[model samples]
Target: MGTIRKGANGGFSGKAGSVIGASWKSIDYIRGLSKKSNKPATEEQLIQQARFYTIAKFIMPIAPFVQVGFSQINANTMTPTNAALQANIKTAVVGTYPNFVLDYAKVQISQGSLQPGGTVKAEVATGMLMISWTNKAIAIQNGQLDDLVYILLYHPELDEFLTAPEPPTRGLGTVDIELPEHFLGGKGQLWLFFADRKNKRISRTNYLGELDLV
Candidate 1:
């Protein structure tokens, strides 16, 4: 411990030699003392961070599903699975259209087994919607792994329907869709289900829930 002193702004500060320091912010914060970097985060870094944050929010709910997917595909570890998932999300966001693609071959090892059970949650914010689910597949012994996901969105007021394909994730799965602000007051229905590697529907469709998009 170097020294502790009261600040003019009614705060407290502490110094530990010339290497670390502490400050009060309602609570004490201790951290390495160093000169702040003059360079700010680059545009590319900011973009990457934004993309990662958005993907994290989108995938957090389905993290369990992703883990299970990795396990079923014999990728029973975190390092590679996380790297691949991050790369996939980056590819999706960088493309003209934002949608996830599954690596079926990697996950198709245990095909034709039993279907996994899980829960899903859907939420809408401004111009975006997120769907996240848990990986209940792990609970099943020798269960059939879902190779793909089919998402169906229907707007009753506009009589419009949108369908998209999503990759199957382990531990949990999540997908983000872009919607117009006009859809705010509109009521809609969302459905999800598992499909085979050949793009064939396997499990019964699950009605995730209805959304007001407000």
Candidate 2:
């Protein structure tokens, strides 16, 4: 604790003590030593931090890809050769099925893809959910050919999983899976997996974590 001394002019100043004193805007204040506590975060803060951790895990690996894709799109104003790069970045930062027709096009100009993608944005369509990716086949030219893509759909409400064919390919591919009519208004997760065909090794996976069909 510090002491406050009254000046001869009827003002106040801090005396030399354990606390440091200063004046701001004509107000005198004391700065005390900081105390260290072994307090744990509350349950709510822990939950929120967990959510942030999850989001960070999802976006970290793909940040560079998104950044490059966004720059290419901005420079050319043409369709990016790696469209999935932009889509994946957008889905990670924002949600799924973002309105590319609206503010999404302006995302690069305004916010940019600097941060981890936002929450998952669910897409609502009639028949099929189309998942696509590129450059997997090119990896084979570098003697890394054993690459496979796995698409998984999980119905949490029903505790069921709908697995798409795990196809092995060289280059770009698209997987279109027909959803059941009953799942039209349901919620679930759509996960994308890239793995090695030989050891069933997974390189990386993108989780479109929470999907709501309408």
Candidate 3:
């Protein structure tokens, strides 16, 4: 039943038949009721959903990093995080839909013109995870000495992440991050990139591979 205050011709504010009457900012509106579909999903739809879920789960853990890593592509229509999501969907997903796996090597949490180190590696020492690289920004045409390094460790199984709250600059060439107490015996993937905050630029992510957190 619709509620009419003024008279029969007055605007309504409730359900009448198949449409819903409402108001926003004092503007009257009527819209068709939402309909539920009984049709089963097609194979393509199922596969697409699986890919989306797989990628979303992986990206959500380091969304803050993605926001900055993929910032160069942000536009009036798309956000940085969505841009990364769309990108990984095309290149990072592997295997068939039901078995879709994230190809870590191809996954890029951030994208920019800044050049990463020529060689990036990770190692576990004591209770610290040390990430080191060979390239000095001066050695690369696109790199900057002050470009900040985006280093992070991700436990896909736990959906937890560890990042340098204040990143080290390219000039340093290495950063030591203390692992969490629970991560000591666990394993996770390590990723790093270079970003120039002054120029609004970022580098392709470097997958330093998985490591034992010990």
Q: Which candidate leads in TM-score? A: 3
The 0-to-1 C-alpha lDDT of every candidate, in the order given, reads: 0.52, 0.46, 0.83
Ranking by lDDT: 3, 1, 2
Output the lDDT of residue 50, model 3: 94
Model 3, C-alpha of 194: deviation from truth (Å): 0.8
**Model 3 TM-score, all chains together:** 0.78
RMSD of each: 13.8, 16.9, 6.2
Q: Which 10-residue span in candidate 2 carries the lowest summed lDDT?
A: 109-118
- Predicted candidate 2 versus true structure: per-residue lDDT over 56-138, tens digit per residue: 44334444333333333433342332343344444444432222121222222112212211222335467576665555435
- Candidate 1 CA-lDDT value: 0.52
- Per-residue CA lDDT of candidate 1, range 37-63, in tens? 889988777766666654454345444
Per-residue CA lDDT of model 3 for 30-149, tens digit only, reads 999999999999998999999998898888777788888887775445777799999999999899969999888888888877778777788997889888886554665477777788
Task: Report the CA-based lDDT of candidate 2 relative to the real structure.
Answer: 0.46
